[model samples]
Target: MALKFKMNRKGWLAVFAGLLLFAACESDPVLTGDEVSYAGDIRPLIDQNCTFSGCHGAGSVQFELLTYNQVKLKAAAIRREVWELQNMPKDRTMSLEKREKFKDWVDAGAPNN
Candidate 1:
């Protein structure tokens, strides 16, 4: 016996759109060497922008970014919020350079160096 499945126009379009998005996302150039740094680049940026009182700091309701491990653990979420969604830093606007750094870091597998 054989089974057959059919998708409607909308379903096909949705699948195509998802594939396109995935391709676009995967097309980002990978960084190496000094392109992105965790201690020198990312930590300072996070400390200044994210880990403030009542935010992602210690004793806060939200996820704490007080250490490298915490930051590394939440790198994906940080990238999404900061780069894709552009909703991070709350009321403050993150600079393009800063946003790019975040994107590059996460895209580089969020190394802890």
Candidate 2:
């Protein structure tokens, strides 16, 4: 019984050490080559946060941000309101990382993609 207990304890210790090594060897997630796109990244974010609450959608703001062109036209304003001033969504707020992505998109000339 004593020998069995010792073997099990050693086995558990080895497993724990292996797990630590595995976790330490793992790398942080990497971003792929595809640059952020308006359609892919920006539009979806706007659709969820901006357009849905009768905020920037139709019959809400004087300018509707539902479409790509509309958003593109107002990219500078979006950057100011969202990134610099951080007064958008009027309820909660986007994560800082998301806000950075939005700023990057705007800085990249607000592409239609």
Candidate 3:
């Protein structure tokens, strides 16, 4: 009797696992933009605006915003500068779209994309 009960429970567990997998297979897709690549999007924003005067350029700056790794190192402070302080570009040239995109990129685990 005990053996039979265990077998029945195992069968139900297997069925539940199959149903979970099938449900996952039917989910909607995740849409991302072509320019959403971190290196392509956010990096360019920093390079064009912040890094011009060797600030975060070919050589590392007080704030390293070149590569994802460099950017991550100073990400919090940079985010503060651009998002919180709004003291970036020193020229008020960074656009709203670029700022929102960068914020999304940073919020999304800062993926290399």
- Candidate 2 residue lDDT tens string, 1-113: 35544458889999999999888878643657656788789988898889865588887756789878888889999999889988886775689888887899888788787
Which of the predicted structures, 1 or 2, would earn the higher TM-score when compared with the native? 1
Please give the clash total of every predicted structure, in order: 0, 2, 0
Over 1-113, each residue of candidate 3 has an lDDT whose tens digit, in order, gives 35544458889999999999999988844665534567778878877887665577766546555567988777667767787777876887887787777667677667776
TM-score of candidate 2 against the unseen true structure: 0.66
Give TM-scores for every candidate, taking all chains together and pairing residue i with residue i: 0.69, 0.66, 0.71
Residue 5 alpha-carbon offset, candidate 2, angstroms: 89
Lowest lDDT 10-residue stretch of candidate 2: 1-10
State which candidate, 2 or 3, has the greater lDDT. Answer: 2
Best by the TM-score measure: 3
Cα error of candidate 3 at position 89, Å: 2.1
* Candidate 1 per-residue lDDT over residues 1-113, each given as its tens digit: 89899999999999999999999999986765657899989999999998889899888797899898999899999999999998998975789889989999999899888
Error of 2 at 33 (Å): 2.0
